[model samples]
Target: MPLRLPPLPALRFFEAAGRHQSFKLAAAELNVTPSAISHGIVGLEQALGVELFAREPRGISLTASGADYLSYVSEAFSLIAIGTQRLPNHRADRPIALSCAPTFASRWLLPRLAGFRARWPNVNVSVDTSHRQVGFPVDGFDFAVRMSRAPVAGTAWTRLFGERFVPVCSPAYLANLRDEQGNADLRRATLIHVNAASEDWQAWFDATGTEGIDTAAGLRVDTIQLAFEAAAMGLGVALGRRPLVDRDIDNGTLVQACAATIASTTAYWLVSAENADRRPELFDFKRWLVSEAEHFDTHANPADQALQSTAN
Candidate 1:
């Protein structure tokens, strides 16, 4: 049979008091009165028939037995804290869940997620990468990052990155491309198509203001990263967001086809409940994202803090 133990409340109070060497500080952390903490510790000492603390003029100090007991208590409390931290990650409410388009999630968000974690270590990020529209109130998600041309009604939205489309292809594809007009020479190349986003091609066609080109006839993909990968593999041309494709463009893996890139009305937007507008975690994420976006616009590598300095 296992040995029965004293009440948990008494043991907890004693442990906190011993660790802090102050009932007042322990009461603050436990959200209890100082007197109550003192009483619980006194009750514990009475039960054990040992002097745990050496009462002093400035503050309390641990007795020989108390010092030994504190080592065990500290380890136990550390284990409890570790377990408690995991509970929030599993909890359904306020889950810090985010919804994003498949292409953006795979190509843009996932690649940069480590930076987000580095900034906010406590936040538990759950990503829902889908092309489908997510209604947050009906879906019970804490937040959603949507890529759209227009903001949805009845939702709080913050524009994450302005839309700027550039035609990008792998270095081999660019080398093989026969264009006397440099960047504007993409009219001869085969255009990659995103099946879900017919508008991207339509916008390109609109910007070119040319006719007799079929935008529908190419290797069709559903995700942005897939299209990008196809382009990177020297298969064909793909229109890419500046924020998502900037790194590839800079590193010589991809090259811009022209300076005719247009800033589209479409943009990456963060959507959430109005009540969560000022949430600290959400706010921190938003600020970081905006900072990165701005940095990328002015400079190439936003992650390299030194890049901006060299450019200036």
Candidate 2:
């Protein structure tokens, strides 16, 4: 006699939906349409002869049976993942997937990745720079870097670094400032703002004690990287974050428009599942990230202190 199983596809969809507590989110994780998720769940309910979800106007919720089913399904998947990871070739060839913010991916991590690659030549790394918050193992990401004011629950997370905002512009743009008076009359200059970091300019202004400038008047860009690029092209002065714009400043493409800087409440966090660091490659990457962040902090502290003093 052979053991029977429910439809695997339907089971998978059910698992995702159950775990996320939302069909739409499950669809996103599985890279399918919400209708597909709904159909799969419907088929699953029919196959099992049980009502798994309680449908509501806004969304769906798992019933008692669905909640119970989810635990077993999740454990089975975890076991399979662990089994595959134990394979020798799987360990060697599997790429570590990391999710990050687009601006941080381009402005900060991408520039520093060469060092990681040089040190670990055999370890493959894949980075996803979508704005969507990653769902960890379900989303197939080994880890993620997120900018957040507070730590996300259920995941092991480390603070990479806090952010500080300072006004930056192309040297040409600064030079073209009327009467070479630095940032004193910034109201007359074009301002570049990143929609994602909307509060930065106002924060900088408050810290510097500069008044009467309209913080909202600017060329709004979607990402800090785009704002930096615009400022580099002499489009406008942009409020740049420390560490992210350090390379541009080093290369002389961007210069401080003023001495004032504002510390941001938000910080970059490296987040992963509790067991993710058990893998040697992932552990190595985590260690390297911490070391890099430490190195940056050491160098940035002096300027940060000066900014703090001025703000005080």
Candidate 3:
């Protein structure tokens, strides 16, 4: 009825030491000082009422009792990792849970989701829009679509798409820029930025080779949709993704300020842990997802920037 478990710090210390066979090595792995690891192991040994290791001149070695205990500890940890990874997809029989950025969800995935439902009629789906970097086994999500220049550590990464962003604004904002120079106009206008990627403005500047741009002069939001909405409402100009704002550009809701476009270092990444991918349901969900991604790509051109003159 009661959960009887050793203190987490002690167990963690023991697990690290056992795996590495050295307090020093474990300490390095865990980002703690060697003295801290030694102290933690000492505490763990007292709690367990047994000697876990033999200190040698060269390094540490596990005692017989320690070796036996380690096997159980290792297995327990493996199971814990498995359980944690499964939690997000725990409702596998129900809705397939997917985590993504709010703007990416709203502008891209949300509109395209109906096709997934229609195709995979038996498989239910749920979407969570968040910018937090959630650990695979800890967050209880089946898979996540993250915006990153490269693969995130400790996860399998699938490249979804490379986004090309161009400066977009409401017609009213462009009217203000009517008299300003090409590069100077953008600098004069209120610039809208997404906070999630700090290098976004810099990368755009580098790609466009547009010098003398000040990134500090504008409003920053975490989600791209918010930035787009702000730009659409005549709040400011935003670097807008072509795929996400295709409909808006078509309908003349947003206008491109310059003919120049830059490729974003941030890309849509489909990610899941190795253990999580082992589940059959996860494979099923992934297969369906790949299909949906292909479908969206078919209609959306990766290249093709329509100017305001043509859009209107």
Best by lDDT: 2
**Scored by CA lDDT, what does every candidate get?**
0.70, 0.83, 0.75
How many backbone clashes does every candidate have? Answer: 1, 0, 2
Worst 10 residues of 3 by lDDT: 303-312
lDDT of 3 by residue, 1-312 (tens): 998887788777787788777787677666899899989888888988999999989889999999998877766776686775557755447566788877678877877768767766787777887434444453356689977889967678887776777888988788888763433287678889888764566677787678887878899887777888898999988887868877778788899877777666777788975664577656867876667677666655434534422332
Clashing pairs in 2: none
Roughly what TM-score does model 2 have, to 2 decimal places?
0.75
How large is the C-alpha RMSD of every model relative to the true structure? 20.7, 4.3, 9.2
Q: Which has the greatest TM-score?
A: 2
lDDT of 1 by residue, 62-124 (tens): 899988877776566555643543464544235466787776677677777799888778777
- Quantify how close model 1 is to the true structure by its C-alpha RMSD in Å: 20.7
lDDT of prediction 3: 0.75
Question: Model 2 over residues 6-53: C-alpha lDDT tens digits?
Answer: 988898898888888888888887799999999999998998899999
- Which scores better on TM-score, 1 or 3? 3
